[model samples]
Target: MAKQWLNKVLELGEVKGGLAWGRFLFDGNRWVTLMEQAPKGKLVGTDYHGNRYFENEGDIYTRKRFVIYAEKRTNAYNPTSVPPEWHAWLNYINDYEPTTFDYKPPVYALKAEVTATGTPKGAWADPDKRNWLKYSAWAPPSSGARGGKA
Candidate 1:
């Protein structure tokens, strides 16, 4: 009864918005406590991005499934930022969850935002030079040259 009421209330948007509030509702006792009542599987693992993954065998409403919940970080939401590994798991590539399996992010993978002043060695910097001459028409060779051919 309480769970049903909570669900109805959330559907009405009474819980509130924003990252902090959403986090509190989804991860806090308000939501988790209710979710616990429902049939849920084990939590596989969380990525550097703070997205949690979960799975369970065939349930009443659906078959083996994958679930993800975003973190409550200050940064605004960006669905495209999800890493490939997590994407594969979400799409059902393997039965085993990444958290349980041996998963390591590649060394070259982008980890964080780049600072403006800190241009680490080997990093490519824009020369800022433009090839505007290419767009214009070609010009003939100079007359002063010693070339015999026109």
Candidate 2:
């Protein structure tokens, strides 16, 4: 949180990948956590985007599955970074692992907000709303509100 505030004030922009996370070039804490969890879990598979999935059946009641995102922490926090097939398995929608070869989202699935934003597909998002430092009168359009219809 402090880093985000500092970035905005200094116009330094967002943190550069994971290097800024710890004293080392890599995320030390994550590495440490993984080292500890290594024995309790086994890697499932890596998705097309390089996100690694793991399943821990060490205990039947506490069995769990999770993904270690390949994207930087900042990018990973964005929900859109996780694709649908992976999400399905993570959420128990499907017990089987998805084949990661050339994984393309289904036509019905929405595109990532980062890709959709500032594009026709995500016109609903208002950049002004994200600009907390600036005052904006922008209001999201209601159903049939912006157009002449209603």
Candidate 3:
């Protein structure tokens, strides 16, 4: 009940002119409201996706570091949005936190996979011909480009 009231007050205060007050109030119990408790260690860093990571000595609630996924815009729950790096940190592959460590993502790994060009052709466009050559026909040469005789 108290937490709900605090959330409402924080929201109202934000709508008003007290921006910092609202932020502080909202951030004060963010871990509790979101993750249901204070983070065990320091908040290391936040990704572009808004997911925050934390780290501390191995203890209860976690054997190593752990992460909290960012709440959706509508505050709905979804776990698939968590990025890979934070996921590794959460699983305790490295002791150093993301904020302190120099993170270098693999060049190819960071690149997005692109699908093959062109949409699927409908029945009106062309019939499926498995053995047909897909190349386009070449245009006839222009007189100007060929330097033709006058």
Best by TM-score: 2
Residue-level lDDT of model 3, residues 42-137, one tens digit each, is: 557887666666555555645445455555222233455555656666766655556677778787776322232342543222335244556889
Q: What is the TM-score of each candidate against the true structure?
A: 0.39, 0.45, 0.42
Q: What are the per-residue Cα lDDT tens digits for candidate 2 across 1-150? A: 756444432221223445554522255544533444434566788766666777877645434776666654432234455677778877788776776544577779875433433434323343334324336688877886666654
Please list the residue runs of candidate 1 whose C-alpha ends up more than 4 Å from where it truly belongs after superposition.
1-39, 60-63, 71-77, 104-150
Estimate, for each residue in 1-150, the C-alpha lDDT of model 1 and write its tens digit.
Answer: 767665653532234566646655655443542354223455567777665555555454333454343533333234554567776776766555666677676899776432345333433442343444436777886887856765
Candidate 3, RMSD to the unseen true structure: 13.6
Candidate 1 overall lDDT versus native: 0.52
lDDT of 3 at 54: 58
lDDT for position 77 in model 1:
34
Question: Any residue pairs clashing in model 3, and if so which?
Answer: none
lDDT of 3: 0.52
Choose the strongest candidate by lDDT: 2
Model 2: CA > 4 A from native: 1-36, 60-63, 73-76, 100-107, 110-150
lDDT of each: 0.52, 0.55, 0.52
